[model samples]
Target chain A: MFAFYTIYKGYFRTALIVQFQYRVAMLIWLLGGIIEPLMYLVVWRTVSEQQGGSVGGFDTNDFVVYFIAVMLVSHATFTWIMWEYIYRIRMGLFSVMLLKPIHPIHSDIADNIGYKFLTLTVMAPVTLLLAWFFDASWRPAPWTLAAFVPVLILAFLMRFYWEWSLAMVAFWTMRIDAMNQAYIVVGLFFSGRLAPLSLFPEIVQRAADILPFRWMLSFPVELLLGRITPRELLIGIGAQLFWLLAGYLFMQLIYRAGIKRYAAFGA
Target chain B: MYYFRLFATYVRVGILGELEYRANFWINIIQSALDLCVALGGIAVVFSHTDTLGGWRQEELLALIGVYFLIGGLIRTLIRPSMIQFMEDVRQGTLDFKLTKPADSQVLVSIQRIEIWRLVDVLISLPVLGIAFLRLGASLGPIESAVFAVTLLSGALIIYSFWLMLSTCAFWFVKVENIQVIFMSMWPAGRWPVNIYPTWLRAVLTFLVPVAFATTVPASAVSGRITGATLIGTVALAAAMLLVSRWFWRVGIRFYSGASA
Candidate 1:
């Protein structure tokens, strides 16, 4: 326990120092994160208004609230480590990382959390700007708000573990571009980045419900926007827990196999 | 004339280099096919819900997709790879070799690297465009066809200039590798008609990112939806951005070469 805490604190401190050095770049990235969801919010709101107040259930204000929630959930859970892993392997940084006493994932988790803490300052104001721009309104029940905390946490863990496992594929393949593209394309469809799962066809919605991607993003956003029923929320949480376990097990297997490959290849 | 020969040489080298790796040809084909499917899938989903997206008919939007792929191919083939190499050179301080060359720096930098395999995007896009044109079911007059060609050229120039300007920022900002991420994020918005976006985003896509000219304007010309004013404006914007990018490239090279000292 003490060793884990020491490694965690050490990684957190290092990430903070590195982020401080490139604060402006981090801010630019934060600006980009702000723009995408805001753009979608406005487009959906326009569509809803044109359709006489709502489309498929979500009204203009519902879109505004849902998208803002999505912005926060996506920011909280998203990982760019797949691209970073490709770079680290290509540039020989992975070897140095492997030599460290601590596991690399501990440092990545610490870095992700640390980076989000720094960027949330920017995201908060941007969220407020979006809310103000769209005149978003939401009134979540106390139970729903209480349920949101654990759902968001599970969503973040599931996303981080799944993407980290995806990144491990870089250890075995020099050409991971095709894999990356495929991952992103599927992620766009499944994770509710393109559109809400509810707005998709019944078949797509069912697939999203069964997959882990919707839990990573759309579930939490829907919960926060008061768009989910209590029964649905319970099912969502149950699904998230199952996927989290699956992702954890998959990560363990992949990491062990990837490390063996890396050791054999001497990289 | 000299630049044409330089481009020919670059293309030949690029093709030969790519040919050495046989697997890369298949990979490129798969990647391009996946890209086409994604675009078509998005269109299918949208049309399934509604007949028109932000006033664009299905056939017209198909033409827009063709222009998107065509210009996308042009960028990947020539502009993106070269700029990426130029940025890498800046990072490694190997740009000095290019600075010593006798040819114009901007031209050389723009054509220095090519992934000849990206011609697949062009090859795939032509058939898509032909099918879209046939679906529109109108016999395009020579005048309209000529206008579409000119607009396509202008749009290409605009995109080239905009990308060159962004890549030139590498001389000043070494960490601008994520600039491509910003561009890629914005490119998806282009997959839809720019008019679908709100006013501010429309303005940004037009005046700021200039993606509207790259895909939409040429597409509008082909669909006979373009106005005289919009056509002239696109041409003027292309010319102005070209000059501005050239000037910026000169300034960037000066800073890189220590001429500011």
Candidate 2:
């Protein structure tokens, strides 16, 4: 544990400096992230306004707040391991990571955290400006705010581990872009990125509940929005915990299998 | 004829190169289907709540989605993949090989690399477009069809010039690949009518990114939402942009040689 901590520390420090060096690229990435939720915000806001100030119980201001919260939460839980793995495998860069004594995920996790740390500085101001622009009116109870932290962390872990396992598909097929894209499309809908869960069709919402995506993104946003009841919050957290463990185990299984394949064929 | 022959040669070469990777063919189909789903799903949800969004009826919006996939297919089929290769060539200083080629460097770079399977998006979108038209119970009169063809041509020209201009920036700016990526990042906005966006955002989508012309204008022509003035403006813009990008390409080539000189 001590050695792992030290390795992560070194990785975090180095990745932070590298991330800062490519600050312009980071800004472009940040722009893409901001645009998604902002697009939904506009669409739903239009819907709400056209429907006489409310659609599916969310007024224009409610939508503004919901989407803004979603932007932050989605940003917090976002994982790029899919693209990262695909590129690394294609470029033969993963061999370096494979040879390292430690598991590669630690460095990826460290890099992801480092990136979020840098971008959150910009995200805060962007969110504030958006809230101001759209007249956001959302105030969670103090308890809701307190509960949000653990839920967000759980969501992040669940997303990272599952996606990291998905990334391991590159070991079997160097071109997993199609698989990755399908996963992304699923997440885009099921995770409430396109719209809030309440607004979706009944069957679709039921599928989202069964899938892990809702637990990863929408649950935290709903929790913070005070839209989730206590029973639902308990159930969501339980589902998140379940997925988190499942993803971790899946990652371990895939890692072992992938590494065997890698050693047999060589990266 | 020369350019067409060159493009044909490149297409044959690209197909031969990818023949071993049959998995790519199936993967591309899945990816294209997934793209259509997200687009259609978003429209489904939006229309479920309201009859019209920004005066675009349900079928019209569905047609917009079809056009989105169609244009996105054209982009991926040639422009994006080639530009990516061009960007990498610039980064690795391998663009010299293209510069030395006797053919026009612009045409050579644009057709050098092709992902033949990405054209599935256009194929898939045809049925979607047909269904949308059927649902609307609208037949495209010959004039409207002509206008659509012209607008789509203009749209394609505009995007080609826009992308080429952006790619040319790599001549001076080594890190302009991410700048190229910014186009795709903003592309989802074109999945809907740009009129739904706020004024400033609408302007950005229209003037800055040209998403309006690239996807919506062509669809609008088909849906009869396009006025004569907009069609003229689009053609005029496409022509101007094509010339400007060609001029900029020459300037960049000169700048590239001068710097090394």
Candidate 3:
């Protein structure tokens, strides 16, 4: 474990330096991460205020806290591997990753961690500004706050493995852009970025509950905001573990299939 | 006549190039469907909570969404793909080919590429816009139609200039493509009326990224929400942005060629 830790430390340090060098790209990327949640934040808040101060169990202030927490949690668990894979496969860069002794995901995981570290400097301050701007209201239970740590880590791993498995589709078709877009659209809906799950229809909420999407992102935010009850928290953790395991198995299957194809086609 | 002939030739060539990639057409259709699901579905979800948001009715908001997709389609079809190519040429040091053309470099770069399949989005959005109008029972007078056309033209020109200015920065900054993400990130904001946002965000949408002019302004014209002052301001801003971007492009080319050195 320590050896694994040291290897990732090296990757993180190098990635941190490279990310720092392109400081403007870093900032541009952060804008995309924050703006979606912020836009939804404004829209939902407006709807709540217009509907006599609250709608569907969340007032304007409650939404303010919900979206701010969402911004942070989404940023933490986000993975760009799907898009990166398309580019890498197009450019014949995946061959280089395959040549490495260690699994390519370890490096990707390290880079993800490194990027989160850099962006949090900006995201943290932005969150504060959003909290101020929206008059966000929340008082977390200390126990729920403690549970947030494991849940967030699980969320990140679940999303990463799932997206990484999706990335392996690059080996089958170089043109996975459409598929990736479809995934993102579904992810956006099921992840509760469109609205809090409570705001959706019973059918939509049930589908979101059964799927891995909510557990990967929105569930962590729900946990952090104390929106999850004790029983629901246990169920949420079970869902996260289930998805994480499923994602791990999916990644193994897809990577094997992808490797076989790459070996045959030599791209 | 020369410009017309040149553009006709480009259309033929672009169509030929697109024909070879038949898969892209299917992909375009699928992606467009998914986009509609998310966009109109979100509107449905929002309206489920309230009747009117920020004083705009549901039909008006649909018109706004139609404008978003229409302008967005146009950009993807002609403007964005061409500019992305121009940026790539800059990175690959092949922009000299564009410079060597008899026509102006900006004009050449702007008309260089077209993903004709992206017109699918425009075709799809037209019906949505029509549905919105039908729902509103909007009767179009000749003057209202003219105002809508004028606003849309000005909006397109404004967006083109803003994007050109942004792509022009490529001569100095090699990775200006990342900067394009700023426009994409802010685009969904235009799905709703800009007035819904805080004053600070409204200013950002209006002035910084120009989404207000490109989408909401034209959509407002269509929905009979545009004021005389807003229409005049859009035209004036479009004209000013064009001139400024043209000037900036010249400066960029000079820098690229080391003429300043």
Candidate 4:
């Protein structure tokens, strides 16, 4: 454990400096993240107003707060490992990664955390600015705020593990774009990125409850919005814990098999 | 006519090169199909909540999405790939080879690379527009068709010029690829009508990026929602932008010193 901690520290420091050098690229990517949710916020807000200030139990202010929460939570939990892995494998960069004593995922996790740390400096202020601009009004209870920390962390882990596992598909075939797009389209609807889960049709709502995507993103946002009950919170956290473990185990299985195939190629 | 033949040759070469990879055609079809699903799904979800969004009906919005993909296909197929190649050339000094050629460097750079598979987006958009038109029961008169054709052409030229100006900035800045990302990041906003955005964002989409002209204005023209003033403004902006971008490209070329130099 102590050795792992030291390794993480070194990786984090390197990642921080490397990411800082490409801060402009990072900020430009963040612009996409910010704009998508903001567009949804505006769209739903328009829908709510046109329907006389409320649609499906969400007022315009509720839509504003909901989507703002979405922007933050989605940003927090998102991972680019799948795409990065494709690039690495295609460029033969993974050969070097495999030579390292440590697992490659550790560096990716460290890099992700380092990037989020640097960008949060910008994201925090932008969040506040958007809140004020959109007239966001959501007052979570103290308990809700306290629970959000652990839930958010679990969401991040669940997303990272699942995406990292999905990245292993690159080992089998380099043509992962279609698979990635399908994943995104599914997540867009199921994770409540397109709209609130509550606003979805009954069948979609059921599917979301069964899928892990909701637990990764929309659950944390919903919890923070004070829209979730204590019972629902307990159930949701249980689902998150389940998916987190599942994703981790699946990642381990895929990595071992993928590494075997990768090594066979003599790369 | 000489330039046209050169363009055709570049396109023919691109097509022949891509034809070597036959599986990529299927992959492109799948990607385009998924993209269409996402666009149509977003409209479906939004219309589920209300009858209209920002005064756009479901079918009209579908038409807008169709145009979004159509323009997006054109960019990916020609403008984006060529400009990205240009940036890479500038960075690696490979641009020296193109500059040494007797042809106009701008024309050569602009039509140099094509991802023919990306044209799948253009083909897929037709069915979407057809469905939208069928649902709207809209008949296009000669004038309406003429206006749309003009606006669409103007929109494409405006976008091509905008991309040229953007890519030309790499002459001074070595790592301006991120600038391309900024354009792409803003591109999706055009998937919807710009008027729904707050005033400031609307302005940015209009003037700074001009994605509105590329998407919403053309859609509006076809839908019979465009005003005369907006039509004239789009054409004027396209003409002005083309001239400015041409001048900017010349200036950028003057500033570019090869990496070996």
Task: Point out where model 2 deviates above 4 Å.
Answer: A1-7, A89-101, A264-267, B258-261
**Each model's TM-score?**
0.91, 0.94, 0.95, 0.97
Best DockQ among the predictions, by candidate number: 4
Task: Write the residue-wise lDDT of candidate 3 on B1-261 in tens digits.
Answer: 888788888888999999999999999999998998888988899999999988888988888888888999989999999999998988888888768789878888998999999988998899998998788775555677788899999999999999999999999987688867889888878888899899999999999999999888887887677899999999999999999999999999888963222
Interface RMSD for all numbered candidates? 2.9, 0.9, 1.0, 1.0
Best by TM-score: 4
Task: Point to the candidate with the largest lDDT.
Answer: 4
> DockQ of all candidates, in order?
0.35, 0.74, 0.78, 0.82
Question: What does candidate 1's lDDT look like per residue over A135-232, in tens digits?
Answer: 77778899889999999999989988999999989887877778877887787788887667778888988888787888899989888887789898
List model 1 lDDT by residue over B1-261, tens digit each.
Answer: 888998899999998898897777778888898888778866676566555666778888899989999999998899889989988888888888888899988888999999988889999899989988898877466777898999999999999999999999998986577787667667656666777776777898888888899999998888788899999999999999999999998888777753222
lDDT for position B50 in model 4: 95
Model 4 lDDT per residue over A75-184, tens place: 98888998999889888889999889999989999999999999999999999999998878777899999999999999999999999999999999989988998899
Q: Which ranges in model 4 have alpha carbons more than 4 Å from their true place? A: A264-267
Residue A184, candidate 1: C-alpha displacement in angstroms: 1.7
lDDT string for model 3 (A78-133, tens) is 88998898778777788898898999999999999999999889998999998888
Worst 10 residues of 1 chain B by lDDT: B252-261
The lDDT of each candidate is: 0.83, 0.89, 0.88, 0.91
Better of 1 and 3 by DockQ: 3
Better of 3 and 4 by TM-score: 4
